[model samples]
Target: MSPYDDVEQTGMGTHGAKESGMDERATLLDFPGADELMAAGQVGEPSAQALSGALARVGTAAAAEAAGRGTGDVAATPVRRLSARRRVLVGMFTAAAVAAGAVTYANAGAGSAAPTGTGTRGETRAAGAGVFLNDMSTVAASQSATTGKYWKTHTKAGDTYLSQSMDFYVMNDGKAYKKGRRPDWQFGPKNVDWKGLDQLTTDPAKLLQLLRTPAKTNDIAPFDQATALLGDTPASPKLRAGVFKAMAGLKGVRLVGAVKDSTGRGGTALEFQEARSLGRVTVDPKTSAILEYTFTWTSGPSKGKVTHDTILSMGFTDRIG
Candidate 1:
């Protein structure tokens, strides 16, 4: 089940109540830290992993090469191409999880205790991707973490359901995650309590190991979800810092400086170049909560095509609606 596996991978619960457009990119094989994480006992046998880290690097080049070294295959949404990043995961971790249906993320509750964070940024602070993520993580860790019974998000995206290319949408759900489900009006809940995330150490190295360890059906979506879960859900500030650090290591990704979201809120952003695609995450300058997740086409026929989800509002709730 390589990230190259011909399995029909669709966006998770993406059939929205509107209109849009889309396409799919294959997963890249990864070999980035398999041996290192394995030696440190973060994952299983190093040999068992298809997407270590080296393969991720190679997969990107390979995808670009397959497309004649163009940028990305930015056309249809149903077909999945490979990238260096998704290669290793789909080739190894994601493939296995897709087959065995054994990949599950931690959803338990986290303690109410809050961790002190570090650093502060102005409305338009500028830094490299690595530094920006690290600084934001410090701020996140410092916020007092409170647990809630429910998880909700007010995200606005460009009709991701085959380019449903629409407007603001909200997701409200319980903590339960059902695999292979369509988008919901009031979806089941996901935890922000950070209870299940305790095993994820604060060390960037160890935290990255956990982020990559999850077996997912889709190569790229998991990456977005991994980081997006921080602002969309509840977690300790230290845990958020770890996630930021982990994602900062992604290839071709960098800080894009201060920007505004659809809501016209000021925030800092980090982005990565994926083939013909670019993905960016923006965060509130003061609170450090994620403000938006944006993906746009930089090349191909769909160039300038963009879709993003803005976290208008989210937090722990007492009950589901």
Candidate 2:
């Protein structure tokens, strides 16, 4: 039998009590009335699968912690020893599993008036944003990709983090070349080289998965990542189409309707409400390219403050200016 079988088969049995000593006995005292609470409808019972999964996760975390400390001797650890730390971890995991079930059950009985996720909350609002984005995807996919050794862009941008609006140019030929910043050719947030970009999938769902991979060095918000691709990168028409399609799925994103960029170019706008600020991106549907992105602080000392970036021009070129 596997290690999880031991957890399934036994509890504080005679064998466990002998190995665990007084600390385990004292910890057990805290849960003396758990069965009574379950019987009185004050607590819900979790599925066996949920409990098993929780135990497996706890075991994995414990093994990882042990390896990190240079112990690397999980196999040598006794299941019955029940150290205070292990007892707490196991209890917390088990409680979390039960709590998940209880919350689901409670929500099921909450009736139609209960609030829904962004996908269903305001159907008209969500539908409008989704339709516009999907239409842009179609337009983008139909466009032929430009060909050149260097991809170049001219942009003016400012954010709460920057002291003033700065006009800049970025040219990339495998490595990035930019003005008014680093002496190094590589600059700005970490992005894949052309070789890495080629590895990215064009399927909307899969593209989002790759962009949101936890191991990526540029681990920021997905919205920011998508806009970055639409901004300065040499993303192909197909890839840009995938990015637009994927963006329709982001939570809390809604239509902001027609808007004009800093350059007075008309575009469709969509905004996402983040925890502390609101982010809005405007796209010029005519060319299926991003025109501007803005953030307005919703809380903290910078409440009501706004910052923006506007794209003047972007395309692949034979030379850098």
Candidate 3:
């Protein structure tokens, strides 16, 4: 049997405790619902475009490994677990593999394992995640204020088409456009204006309270509203800090430490689970910027499918370009 088969089957090495040829230090744990995820779908053939995007997302190490070999030739590469700072790196690589057609990730169930330098199970730690967000509030509050003619945000959203991902841009002045699609204000949440955004209260509690008002938030969940505001607007430092603080107060926001965003930038991930799906938001610990937001449908018609909205760049820009 191939090494990949071994990983998919027993998930153990010769000694029955460690992963073969990967990290010997971390113990191999059976993830919950491994059988189900595996049965859901098998990894299909990797497309050239998907492989190129994956390699580019992984950066130097994976690139160096694939330097001589063509992208398709690296199919034999062994998957690794998350370890210390490498957690995000491995996550991105594994995600790329998934996007490249590896549907069954062996490490998905390692939610109970603590993140060391060896590997991660992508589990959430409640207390740890809360503390991290509170700290981020402080970090965000210290950033210098910025302003420009328009608040611009560039995003790469879910693959609803053959291209595998959709790229779009939204401007605060009610203009939205994407490649191969006509420009419209319908790309983002409706009724959000720069003037309204500027007048938002900087107080965390009041801001959250206001968001909870169904009329102002368009009846969207306050958490979703807050994250949407954070991602699409160039809110002031205090307002940005307020968003973090408000999120910290929300229950079930767990920390999946040191995971990479869709763009492959390492950041801390905060997740909240609803009845039908799980939503995760990754933020840069240093800058407290929202890097990516992913939603995975767990128990619906869309079960096992994942969609990610990644903020490629966001700030006050002189022109909407």
lDDT of 1 at 45: 28
Model 1 per-residue lDDT tens digits across residues 1-321: 333443333444557412212223312222332222222212222333533443564455446554662434433433334344344343333223212212111111111111112223211112355544544554464456776654555456311111111122332342333233223111012222234455446677765665455443334533465555576545566777667666655545555556788889877676666677877878774456888888899999999999877777776655434
TM-score of each: 0.47, 0.50, 0.50
Give the true-structure RMSD of model 2: 17.6
Q: Clash pairs of candidate 2?
A: none
Candidates in order: C-alpha RMSD to true structure = 23.0, 17.6, 16.3
Per-residue C-alpha lDDT of model 3 across residues 66-169, encoded as one tens digit per residue: 36445553335444432222433443454355334433211122122222222223322122444455555655765679877655566664211111112334
* Whole-model Cα lDDT of every candidate shown, in order: 0.47, 0.55, 0.54
Question: Candidate 3 vs. truth: CA RMSD?
Answer: 16.3
Off by over 4 Å in 1: 1-126, 156-196, 210-218, 221-225, 299-304
Candidate 2 lDDT score relative to the true structure? 0.55
Model 1, residue 71: displacement in angstroms?
Answer: 64
**Off by more than 4 A, model 2:** 1-127, 156-191, 211-219
Evaluate model 3: give its lDDT: 0.54
